[model samples]
Target: MTFTSHARVDTDRPARYLKQLCSHFDRKANSTFDEEKGRTDFEFGVCEFLVEQGALVLDLTAGDLDQLDKLEFVVGDHLERFGKKDGLAVNWKRD
Candidate 1:
């Protein structure tokens, strides 16, 4: 099965949050940050902003599916819904 991920960009501190989230994927998510998009500042800013929002980075990857054997918590719920920008998205509903 092919896996697709939908994430919310912090636009302020992305790297830090990205790292925090990737930890679930073994503390080192397989994804790489692309600098060609001129997102160096935006990346870091988003990461920092996440800290303010009380959101923890999961850092999950497709491979983690095989090793951890843990499900139901890989991807986050707060992903923005595609095909309908109605401003109504499904958040994972933290307990």
Candidate 2:
């Protein structure tokens, strides 16, 4: 079965982060993104990003719980690092 999780990260520059993440991941994974939305396909899972008014929405899917956990950590860790200046954090809810 597929596992999924969602995270809404509040940030002033959602578009900037989205673009940065997509660009960075593109080097290693299949990533496609614009200013408003992005998607990255990893070997274990997929992550979809959306830039909202004041937040970045992430929808992640994986083949299993282990993959889902890894996806969360990988995406959240990178995003937090990129937004470290703003004290960004990602709190995900499983679905």
Candidate 3:
């Protein structure tokens, strides 16, 4: 009934990356980000992302298993772009 994913980024200043991501959705999606707390929360379709732990921890949830695939792709793509300079490796998987 529900699908969830988790990703931990091994990089310096992970919070900055998460903040960058949350900013991207500030205008379009219903979202909220707290850079100080290193947390970002966003709602996209049937999916939701909860990024915390200085951006090192990423939690994604969707209404259904199928929806999670697209959600994961979207999140991963954005993260890849943000971490491109540092070549940060983010390994996220269904959990």
Point to the candidate with the largest TM-score: 2
* Best-to-worst ranking by TM-score: 2, 3, 1
Candidate 3: C-alpha RMSD to true structure equals 3.0
Candidate 2 lDDT (Cα, 0 to 1) = 0.97
Among all candidates shown, the one with the greatest lDDT: 2
Poorest 10 consecutive residues by lDDT, candidate 1: 38-47
- Could you tell me which residue pairs clash in candidate 3? none
* Residue 83 miss distance in model 2 (angstroms): 0.5
**What is the lDDT, from 0 to 100, of the residue 91 in candidate 1?**
33
Query: Compared with the true structure, what per-residue lDDT tens digits does model 1 show for residues 1-95?
Result: 32222233333444444443334333332333332111111111111112324232222223333322222233333223221243323232211
TM-score versus the correct structure, for each prediction: 0.28, 0.98, 0.77
Candidate 2: where are CA atoms >4 Å away? none
lDDT of 2 by residue, 15-93 (tens): 9999999999999999999889999999999999999999999999999999999999999999999999999999999
Cα-based RMSD of candidate 2 = 0.5
User: What is candidate 3's CA lDDT for residue 36?
Assistant: 46
TM-score of 1: 0.28
